[model samples]
Target: MASAQDAGRGWSMAGRCLTALVGGYAAAAGLATLLARLLPVARVEATAWGMILSFLFYAAFGLWAFHEPRLARVAGVIWGIAIVTGGAALLLGVRP
Candidate 1:
């Protein structure tokens, strides 16, 4: 019973959900790795701090994914952060 427009909208919503989950998690992980490396603390403390902050990053990314009006923009920002942070983490010698 759905019209074409409805189907398209459904797909768009689905894309947003996918981005929020996967992209958000990726961004969070990258940020955590980078922070773990950068924090001026003992290794154990820095890693613990990174793990705590990663949850915030993920939640913030998820909220932003929903708040942005354009789907492409949402994907770009989320994925862009993921790539940049991940790349930086790798460059800093953070092990996978």
Candidate 2:
């Protein structure tokens, strides 16, 4: 029988995992798209660079999500970056 404390801990961990995976992916994709659009190079090369950097972005976001103590802060920062970068890329006419 799981106590309330244990249940809360489980939920918290679940939230952190989801934020680190899904939210982190979103943030990485958004940043990659922005980079692809903004790099001053040939289209193919720019896109390649973005693709290469996306892995680092994901890893960084995942690490930060786990390192943060507050779930709300983690969610807000990760999702906020995802939305802002995605929106900027869209506005800049970068096709995802």
Candidate whose lDDT is highest: 2
* Whole-model lDDT, model 2: 0.93
lDDT (Cα, tens digit) per residue for candidate 1, span 1-96: 335768888888889999999999999899988999998888899999999899999999999999999999999999999999999988879533
- Where is model 2 more than 4 Å wrong at Cα? 1-4
Worst 10 residues of 2 by lDDT: 1-10
Q: RMSD in angstroms, candidate 2? A: 2.6
Name the top TM-score candidate: 2
Residue range 1-96, candidate 2, lDDT tens digits:
336767888888889999999999999999998999999999999999999999999999999999999999999999999999999998889443
Model 2: how far is 51 from its true place, Å?
0.2
